[model samples]
Target: MAADMAREVKLWNDKREREMYDNFADLFAIIRTMEKLEKAYVRDVISSKDYEPECTKLIAQFKTLTTSLKDTVPSVERFMETYKMDCPAAVNRLLVSGIPATVEHRASSSDVGTAAAVAECVQHFITSMDSLKLNMLAVDQLYPALSDLLSALNRVPQLPPDFEGKVKGREWISRLRNMGASEELTEQQARQLLFDLDSSYNAFINSLPKSA
Candidate 1:
């Protein structure tokens, strides 16, 4: 009985060890993918429309995985070294930076504040619209998307304090907050929200400086 228990324990340990390595493999892949994405964006091989969402998704996944592996993967840089990974761009993007490259480029412009804010507003607007299109209509999903849009709208120095986008975004966020996190918007609600977003996006575009 003692020998059998030992064998079973060893097998269980082996299984868990394999799982950990699998997660490491996933982490490795995300990093490599991010590096390629960064290069593609720099080379203009991919449009910002195609790059931003994929970059955002990878960053989110990287964050979640790193959080889970905090105990075992104490340092991401160290992990990279162990794996012989040479993705400096991914290291900077996933580890050092918080925002996407599109936003980062705008932020480094001569008119840093306005440029960055405009980029942020555009990004959030696109994110919100894409979320709705993807049927991510649950209260939790919609609330954050709208909230981020509102926040970004507020940051644009050229936009009025009561821009239509800001007003509509706030109203939607309020409605979403009143619902349970898991609750989905009805079809009519989703339609109305999409209409409002489209209208606001057009208005936002018109509000931009002609040179921008």
Candidate 2:
């Protein structure tokens, strides 16, 4: 009976380890995504308005995940004390990962004035795109802002020399130009174009230089 209990406890401890590992992995992914956002914000690839809110949201999620991990630690500690077991492999692995340090370092590095301004502009543009009401007035408002964003993105010095070619050598811009001049698109087509533009904009954002 003692041997059976030990085996059962071992199984439970292993299960908990795996669960912890999974949560750690999820938190790591979120951290990486936040890193991407920070890099874009720093390099003027995104706007502050967009970056601040998005960063806040991700940080909240990160906090919640960490809290969950913290709450589990006491239980794991009790299990260790009761069973005379060392730390589980998952927790040990997490300690080795050093995720907290990584997240803090990445976020701190991106705090710059110019980047903050650009990040704000990117956010405003995104907001403007989202605010379109499918009416003629909205369409008219969107065209100039869309053109300006495209122009600004193209001018960002951090973009690689061949960036345009990689994104089909300004074909996306041409699509925008055509739409801008013609203004013949029905409401549905206009909305779809805005969606496409957003996709293109994000693709550009992701293409900017990644942090080392």
Candidate 3:
């Protein structure tokens, strides 16, 4: 009599299937990490300085991954339920709210003007970055995004007059103004503008009052 053999198991049968499974795994990891980050922030185990960047990155990644997985993973909540994931906090933070807890707290706080300004600044920063990523390089397109960011920055009285975001935004707006509206940013210009925007965004987030 032959000994019984154990069957080998595979989660995916083809290259496409493997890729989908990998994406699903990445999605799970992002949600789980977000849950941990949310808990740590609530407990004050991590400072806002450390928390915001990580939360922002995770939220971005989650959005990108979910968009890619839209066909296969029609619903994130369904996927979570299928996986038996118990992460209400992560669900709220990543899905329902789609913003960092610190930002939500700030928006809810009594300082409505500053809170609203900060939120506007954050939205403009994200919009500018997304536009660049999508190659929306026309001077007209880029100028408005930067202009909005600068306007939002100006609304925040807490930021100094010499803030880096303000200076870089003004410089970029000036450069764009001289160009024809239909003219597009060169690859180099786009890259530099993205870098400046990212730097300014970080500075803006860091300059936020911890209590806010």
The number of the candidate with the highest TM-score is 1
Q: Which window of 10 residues has the lowest lDDT sum in candidate 3?
A: 1-10
lDDT of 1 by residue, 1-212 (tens): 88877774332358779778778888999999999999999999999878866787677567656755789999999999998999999989888985578757765567777666665676567667766765767887778767877887887888887889988888888888889999999999999999999999899989987655
Q: What's the lDDT for all of these models?
A: 0.80, 0.50, 0.83
Q: After superposition, how far is residue 95 of candidate 2 from its true place, in Å?
A: 45
Give candidates' CA RMSD values in order.
8.0, 15.7, 6.2
Residue pairs of candidate 1 with colliding backbone atoms:
none
Best by lDDT: 3
> CA lDDT of 139 in candidate 3?
82
TM-score (C-alpha) between model 3 and the true structure: 0.57
Where does model 3 exceed 4 Å of error?
1-8, 108-212
Count of clashes, each model: 0, 5, 0
User: What is the Å distance of residue 111 in model 2 from its true position?
Assistant: 8.8
Question: Candidate 1: where is the Cα deviation over 4 Å?
Answer: 1-37, 40-91, 94-110
Clash pairs, model 3 backbone: none
* Per-prediction TM-score: 0.58, 0.35, 0.57
